[model samples]
Target: MPRNTLVNTGLNLLGLDYKPLTVTIAAMEADTHFGFEQVSPNEKEGRVMAVFSSVADKYDVMNDLMSGGMHRLWKFRMRQCSAVRQNHVVLDVAAGSGDIALGHLRKMGDTGRVILSDLNGPMLHEGARRMLDAGYLPGRADCIQADGSCLPFADAIMDCVSIAFGIRNFVAIEAGLAEFYRVLKPGGQFICLEFSRPVLPFLGVIYDTYSFHMIPQIGEWVTGDRDSYQYLVESIRRFPDQKRFSHLITQAGFDLVRHENMTGGIVALHRGYKL
Candidate 1:
């Protein structure tokens, strides 16, 4: 039997009647996770891109539905912990719909700038639109399509770097953290908001039930894309737990690293400095 390495994708997306050509070469030299299933590194990015492309339009709505609007509260707390000041330059990686960047902007008091970077063009475009709609000046918010593991900016340029619920999906999370460390100025801050293990036993049971069963079903009902939502839920499970992830951040040269669990540890906010 021969492995079929070509895939055809045609969707009328963005109201543009667009169709995309995706050629995936499955190289098995190294394997990674596309949800729970193992896939080659070459195949993971294309699959992840497909998932985001399918859900880009309904991403925000589905997030609200899935979290019952608690995601907003979590993000507010993250912004408060950011300690953003005037004249700062913050990079929000995997900045879906620009939530973190927008929150940072509000904290910056119209004085600082932000870059919303995501690998998926459709997702990044959605973020850019939200930034413009929020009346953030073009000079203040710029959107770039770039991988989190391999940023395009010069070293020591950013005063703060952040990623929310995004690093888990990175094919090489350690590389992405190293990139964050490399790009931050001395004493700069790094913040990450991500899904983590629930603290109490009962809460963990309930969360797993909802995450594995309810999320994908609701996602299909809302976005007509069940597989992407399924992958999203599994990715959360695959992510490192709060304490282990905090140690990984410290290894990336961030000092004074700490994490605060929110919503009973279903989500955690980790903060550290490049000092």
Candidate 2:
């Protein structure tokens, strides 16, 4: 890596401005995973953003195509577990297209609010637009361009925190989890709906075959971006499995963390409570 690249990374890692933090540069330059490829932590964010930006308009369509529309059902299960009540505040991180956010808005009653956040501006804009199209009031849902690793919100304020199909893209998974924990009110819920390793060996075989072969091809035909889909499929494999992820939630200071696997474990909904 270039010396200047390392300097910039150090600044980001330390949450500082342009001042060079040379002391942390060596430690911060360790390569992180971007899909199956190793990339600088700084580079991985841009790469992931590029991938989502390329597919922002087509993200919903591709989700339906790849999951056979089961993504909706999985998200429904996520909402069921979310258990958001009237007057509660929800912060949905990396909230791509706002499907999960819209679901909450409908159920959270008129007084309740949801904040939809995404790192990619295009993805955030798409999500905000869809929420409006669904008849949700602008005040009922707020859209912010934010990063999961370091949210701009105050501590212990959100009644529920969520991320759907987006956590695996984080360059610092643990950091993001800590931020979730930090932002949630005591007794708040943390709901994560994500793709996971298949439990059935045969299902794994079929899934791998389809994901490695067909998903990228489908992406190319639909969004004219095969490489982005290729990286997304690889990212699911790189993410920690159900048990490991549950442990991570626990380590983030949550209690009663558990996961329910859907579609033979191809998707998992992990719920935790901040007590």
Candidate 3:
């Protein structure tokens, strides 16, 4: 059986209903942003999950084709910022296809533990499959289905928490950051890699055209799903810029917060610490 399958089974046996609880809590709040539109917080997760589930099988391929393999370089930059130690414990939220988790594993020697987590079961399954194919020992990394706003782990247990291109999809970005902060050990790092406002003057025009037009077209051609990728592009536009997001990180009780823009600010890597 797949690792994610075991994790899900354990969740079921424990009767932990993370999704509905998160949605219910979010629904109690005011309207939240979902892509370019304002939607009930309860609706955002379902919509995001739908998108991930639809693309799980082709996610890796789409990443390569969409970014021309630049995402690998971007993630490598994130790893450099992470400075993961050999025996540290890392939690990768919204792990997706496990690219970030795999990088963490490579740096974290045999004793290190990497928890690959995602809210969508299918995506976690896909991530686990990739981990196995990469020859990762079964115990070196564990798969978990979890909510970013409400991680099941106890406080101050993780050495580092890293999220890539995933925070923008959260119903409540602050809430998710708070949860991430809660799980980190003292002086632990929180590294977020996400799309940011493009800095180059004319690049925005070209990027917008490609995102709004070519992206959905590519999604339709590759995954037979256009709406999901459309949402993806819109969400990038809707997400807060680097300075604003760094502020959010600080608000979540992380100190020494800072961010570095990559590729002329098309993407940014935000770093903070629980001091």
Please report, in order, the local distance difference test score of every candidate based on alpha carbons. 0.82, 0.82, 0.85
The pairs that clash in candidate 2 are none
Per-residue error for 123 in candidate 1, Å, reads 0.7
In order of TM-score, best first, we have 3, 2, 1
TM-score, each model?
A: 0.89, 0.89, 0.91
- Cα lDDT tens digits, model 2, 67-136, are 8999999999888888788988888998889999988987887788787878788788888788778766
**Which regions of candidate 2 are displaced past 4 Å?**
1-29
Q: What is the lDDT of candidate 2?
A: 0.82
Candidate 3 local Cα displacement, residue 200, angstroms: 1.6
User: Per-residue lDDT of 116-162 in model 1, one digit per residue for the tens?
Assistant: 88888778778889887988746687776677776766678789999
- List all candidate RMSDs to the true structure: 8.0, 6.1, 3.7
lDDT, candidate 3, residue 254?
A: 94
* Candidate 1 clash figure, as a count: 0
Better of 1 and 3 by lDDT: 3
